[model samples]
Target: MATAPTPVRHRPTITRTAGDVGAVYQFACPCGATGEEQAARRMALVDLNEHVLSLPKVPAAQQCRTPRTHGNQLWEPCGLCADQTSLFDLEVS
Candidate 1:
């Protein structure tokens, strides 16, 4: 007799939500993981990013780079890269 194939598992999506108190936020994942309430939205975003990075088969954040516009390079780091850096810095501190 042929054996049945195993079901595939999908990664949970992480999202940020406002907390009960004003100016506070937290992140939750479908997998039942949650972040502690944070006063700064940036902290919530960092928590979400950390969860994403912990999952299997996920790609690492891209390196920071200045984008060129009309033959001139912008002075700011890419938003995604900046966020990624901030997440790591927070983790280390």
Candidate 2:
């Protein structure tokens, strides 16, 4: 039986300052298909927070990827949505 590969362990870059800190994380999820035709999708970006980053602990049935950017070192969520969670949880996870 075929199985999905394990999540990649990334050594994130950490920066600290009087104001706040942030890190950049990058990963790729492969498309489910056969042969060379199957392409690998990718995600990457920088998430900033005063604390740390984390994500919920769940077994990934399929690979996932995300990318982010920080226009200002100040570091804040792109938008405010009730459903959206903080990057702090995402970075640690």
Candidate 3:
């Protein structure tokens, strides 16, 4: 008997780019879904967070809370706070 091949999974990547006024962020999923523009750096991260969080396929644990862009480097979770808390902390400020 032959087995079926597993499907490929692609996560969205949020990239920060400099804008005419200020820093801007654009997130694009492998499926071609794009995120909104945010003036504030943190706000941009929040937009990316919300996009991924809304997806039914992504689990709570797998969702990154404190995502940071390291000076044109890698984008990953900072592991400082939980997904829920991090969102609140960033928004409340």
Candidate 4:
């Protein structure tokens, strides 16, 4: 008998939180991953982007395609959905 493969969790979104004046900035992912505190906002953003890029890529076909709403308007083909499609296409070609 073969063991079943573990289900892959959707990539956790990472966000950067602003710190008090003179305090260092920090970035954290919902998956419990975190970055070292940095004195610059740019550094914090870089850390967050790096974490997102490091996660395993989900196939475009398997990614969520749900419509997203911004303000009062509904965005057909969510930005994330578009990005995943483009990214996957790049990897395949």
Best by lDDT: 4
| Cα lDDT of model 3 by residue, 1-93, tens digit | 122234233367778888888778777777577778766667766766776666554234333553443221123232333345456555552
TM-score, candidate number 4: 0.50
Per-candidate total of colliding backbone pairs: 0, 12, 0, 0
Clashes of 1: 0
* CA RMSD, predictions in order: 15.5, 17.9, 13.8, 9.8
Candidate 2, lDDT over the whole model: 0.27
Residue 15 shift from truth in candidate 2, angstroms: 3.7
In model 1, which regions exceed 4 Å deviation?
1-21, 58-93
Candidate 3 stretches greater than 4 Å from native: 1-8, 57-93
Better of 3 and 4 by TM-score: 4
Task: Provide the lDDT at 2 for model 3.
Answer: 24
The per-residue C-alpha lDDT of model 4 at residue 11 equals: 36
lDDT of 2 by residue, 1-93 (tens): 133244333333332223223332333223221111111121232231111244323222221222233221111222322124433345542
- What local lDDT does model 2 show for residue 20? 27
In candidate 1, position 77 carries an lDDT of 24
| Alpha-carbon runs more than 4 Å astray in model 2 | 16-57, 60-93
Please give the RMSD of candidate 3 to the true structure. 13.8
